[model samples]
Target: MGKEFIELFEQWADHYDETVTGHDLEYKEVFRHYEAILAEVAKRTFGHVIEFGPGTGNLTEELLKRGRTVTAFEPSPAMRNLAQEKIGNRAEIKEGDFLSFEFKKSVQSIVSSYAFHHLTDKEKAEAIAAYGNILESGGKIVFADTMYESVEAYKQAIKDASEKGFHNLAEDLEREYYTTIPILKEMLEANHFTVSFEKMNDFVWIMEALKK
Candidate 1:
């Protein structure tokens, strides 16, 4: 499933900006909310930031604007190319999966938006462990992604999509793996992260955890 999503994203890379720009008003609002979160993270950790799953450099550009050194990682080749074009020498864009990517150096912060939920539950747990291993002490991990109110809510979302003629579209879209805030908090805490969350509207949630 991860490989399939990578392929789909590669095909969508060329038209990603156009397809997303103002196409979904709700999603656009989500991005704006994400930008605000990025600003806060930038002010708190202004050096040596690493961003995972920077599909097309949207948030990467924002981090660079704040004068932070950014390492942007995206798995899809086409998406990485587009990000490199947009960011140029200001940012280092690399092609690698966040779940498996390694860095020789530690970073002051790691940020991801609308991307981490694609990982399986085990993968998500592993990612938190990886972040713990790579992050400098007192560094932060800020992430925004889909969060379900309950297990039933997730099931309803799946049912709603199927009934609205979106089953196929949803299937083709990135598969989301969601967990409640408590579950996420437990995972982060187990990994030695102090976690907090802010619900941004109904569809998205922003979580910030500082390494202790």
Candidate 2:
């Protein structure tokens, strides 16, 4: 699962909002158009939704605004607390990760933002497979996160970040499980999902996968 990064998220909980708002220079490009990205994901989601790594609940808020019922999971206690405080009782925010969660209701969509990179490629595939089992035909998975077009692009990103004196960003790019689009496309298709992607920023892309 993605719970391995829970400690980082716990320490980042308080300042996560600030980072997404472009206040952090190193991550500014990574979180560019943050609000718009959330809105776009929310717009594409429908009916009962399962949201992974809700973080501070920014996307959850967007989904609620659109009248979508949301069931969210977060591995970090600090992040989960902030999300609950921000969202109140409107949606349930549980202690879970992408590969470990419980849901009984019929879910029409799954949504997440800036959080999936914590899982390695194999784990990502596992999570998608689980979603494939959980959702019916026509169910959707909308996720906005940092993904590259190719392996070269991913390496160049780390290099570019380093040249820009963004050591932290470069290290994060190297440390995290950030992957390329082709691999994700293959995983989605293997799980019987027809997927499309749209660029959201220099470092972010929106993956909209529909169960087939």
Candidate 3:
């Protein structure tokens, strides 16, 4: 488990969603925006599902309504509690980090939102490989997250953040980082995932990588 992340997210559990959307002006709609895409995926995908980080169970709520049995790996106890309260026994909750958590059974797809970027490039690769390992053939990873164009773009965003009165947020964004889509594509491809997109833009993306 990532001790640092555990503490950080626990502290942020209450305002996590607001914090993310509020600070990233352009992506405030990402949460609501991803519903339709994931809904489309649930219709097309099959078997059991797993979600990496299910903050307030917003997406989890949608998944349950669509009849997909979901298991969520959310490390923050507070967030997990919030999700538990939000969705009850509708979905299984695993209070652990994705990297440390074990996949007990094979699943059809692994889904996530705004969570993968928490990992470094190497860890992202490892997590992708883990998803591949647990999924049955044809099973995939469907996720939406911040995908920057370059290191410079993220750096510049920091300046823009300060100019917008988000000094603390700018500092935080400065700490957060990402790997470009091309690089993420190569990593997924190398791990035997054929990548596709449900949504694509300069800063964020909703992607599907089918395991081969």
Clashing residue pairs for model 3: none
* Tens digit per residue, CA lDDT, model 3, 45-117: 5668888778778778777887888888888888899999999888888877668786779999888877777
Better of 1 and 3 by TM-score: 1
lDDT of 1 by residue, 1-212 (tens): 15547877888798777645635442454444555665665565556998988888888888888888988778888988898899888988876776867588988899887777777777888889998998999989988777776777767766765666665434633355667777788889999999998777455677899999
Model 2 segments more than 4 A misplaced: none
TM-score of 1: 0.86
Per-residue lDDT of candidate 2, residues 23-82 (tens digit): 999999888899999999999988999999999999999999999989999899899999
Comparing candidate 1 with candidate 2, which one achieves the higher lDDT?
A: 2
Clashing pairs in 2: none
Candidate no. 2 TM-score: 0.98
lDDT of 2: 0.93
- Report each candidate's C-alpha RMSD, comma-separated, in the order given: 2.7, 0.8, 2.8
Mark the regions of model 1 whose C-alpha exceeds 4 Å error after superposition: 24-44, 162-174
Question: By the TM-score metric, which is better: model 2 or model 3?
Answer: 2
